[model samples]
Target: MSNRGAGGLLGRRPPEEETGLPKDEIFDLMSNHRRRYTIHHCKQADGPVSLSDLAEQVAAWEKDKSISELGSAERKTVYTSLQQTHLPRLERAGIVTYENGEVELTNQTERLDIYLDIVPENSIPWGVYYLGLSFLSCLVVVGLWMDVLPTGAVPTLVYPTIIIAAFTVSAAYHALANRRYRFENLDEPL
Candidate 1:
């Protein structure tokens, strides 16, 4: 075989072609706090969201206040930003459709979830947690291999079995935690 291209033997294709948007542009779109809030609100919305209403929600979140308590200045700043800049950018990216003073997420928006991993505040990053787990597992295996730690009547089989069980349980918990961050479950707190 002379070649093994990204899209099979046919040939390599750009990520933009495959995912409908380039990874760089996707990252660029997510770079702004307001844009991120817009996407999050749109995902939680049942259907098309009015620009003014969306701006209110975003302003409230940004100010850490209830919608009813939002000042006109806070709402106006977010509303103008969304109307003039954020929505048009998102519309061009095909992640959302903006029309008739309303906004709705498009199919292309689904492709973005992979980039939008929402790690809650004060929580350990999953990568760091998994790395620590793997390291601890290795130490256990090494300890047994060198006889530095005693099993104390526990069978040799039980050591690796415990390790496997730990991994299995951790993986299951990780999966469930991830699902909670998804858009469909936005009704729950992050």
Candidate 2:
């Protein structure tokens, strides 16, 4: 008889407790490649993307072909799947709003960024990289303090300055890479 509402037991937290969609819901939504493509297209678009155009791009990517090379059948198949399954689920999750044959992202779309980490292949994750850098810097400081490093003859201020410089440069590079890898900025005009 408890009126737990749509959230049910899986996520019955009050409004303030919700950051975005629940983690399970997000995983469910992103589990399908089609849905990921749909989100990518919606994010890249400056305005709502028409269903046909979105399907065309998605089909093209799926088939490894250009949009112009996609057959009507391929486009239709994707369009149907998106219209009947993927899009509606996204709409319900508040990740997207679908209406009038067009799709646009909702505020909830931003919440997925943490899950959709944009690390390039062979590149270390930013958090891990930063942690390693901190550890190394700590080790260097310890060495300097113990007079174990070759920098024993170096100025005391040089150690702190070098450590600060390393961090500053890493932060700047991370900022640039963050912009480059952000999904919304892909294929978008500057």
Candidate 3:
């Protein structure tokens, strides 16, 4: 039998594999500004935040950082870093919870702590998965063209259709999941 204890508020097993390291790792990873913003928003006592709020805060931060004039490229870099790098890792660690229209923290302290051990080295580039599907779909289509597979047994259009549908749905799900823990503004003193 697994080592996971029985179900209780905090005793329940994490949705993913458990690591032996202490939970401080989560906070350590949060040492960075982008990662810290995500954690503070989700785990903060105030409450959950919306994606629009997050986007707005990011925009405001960009403006505030300008000495005289703001660089669009710099602002874009921050935004991209938050959305592509920090948030995805936090989501994978299960520190943030996503739902209908808001993001909140999952109150599993033990699990949350355990998640700290596995710092997300990089955001999972979902676009790569879509691209892979596209390439595979093309290959399957080519096979059909060469008559490698029996005609009518498998529809020529089915592969690409499935790839498109799967990628679309998965991307949507990931977006929603990441958005769950987003806080509107983190510039305010916490």
Among the numbered candidates, top TM-score falls to 2
In model 2, where is the ten-residue run with the lowest total lDDT? 10-19
Candidate 2 clashing pairs, residues 3+ apart or interchain = none
- Clashes in model 1: which pairs? none
- lDDT for each residue of candidate 2 in 65-167, tens digit (9 for 90 to 100): 9999999999999999999999999988888899999999987777677666566789988889999999999998998879887864777888889899999
Query: lDDT of model 1 at residue 30?
Result: 89
**lDDT of every predicted structure (CA atoms):** 0.85, 0.83, 0.55
Candidate 3 lDDT over residue span 81-170, tens digit each: 766676666666666664454556665434553233222236556567667867887777787779885668777677667767877887
Better structure of 1 and 2 per lDDT: 1
| Residue 122 of model 2, lDDT score | 98
Q: Where is model 2 more than 4 Å wrong at Cα?
A: 1-19, 150-153, 187-190
Among these predicted structures, which one has the highest lDDT? 1
TM-score of 2: 0.83
The 10-residue segment with the lowest total lDDT in model 1: 181-190
Tell me the tens digit of each residue's lDDT in model 1 across 1-190: 7567666456766658766887798889989888888889988888999999999998988888899999999999999999999999999989889999999999877778877867777999888998998999999999999998777787888888988998899899999999987744664222
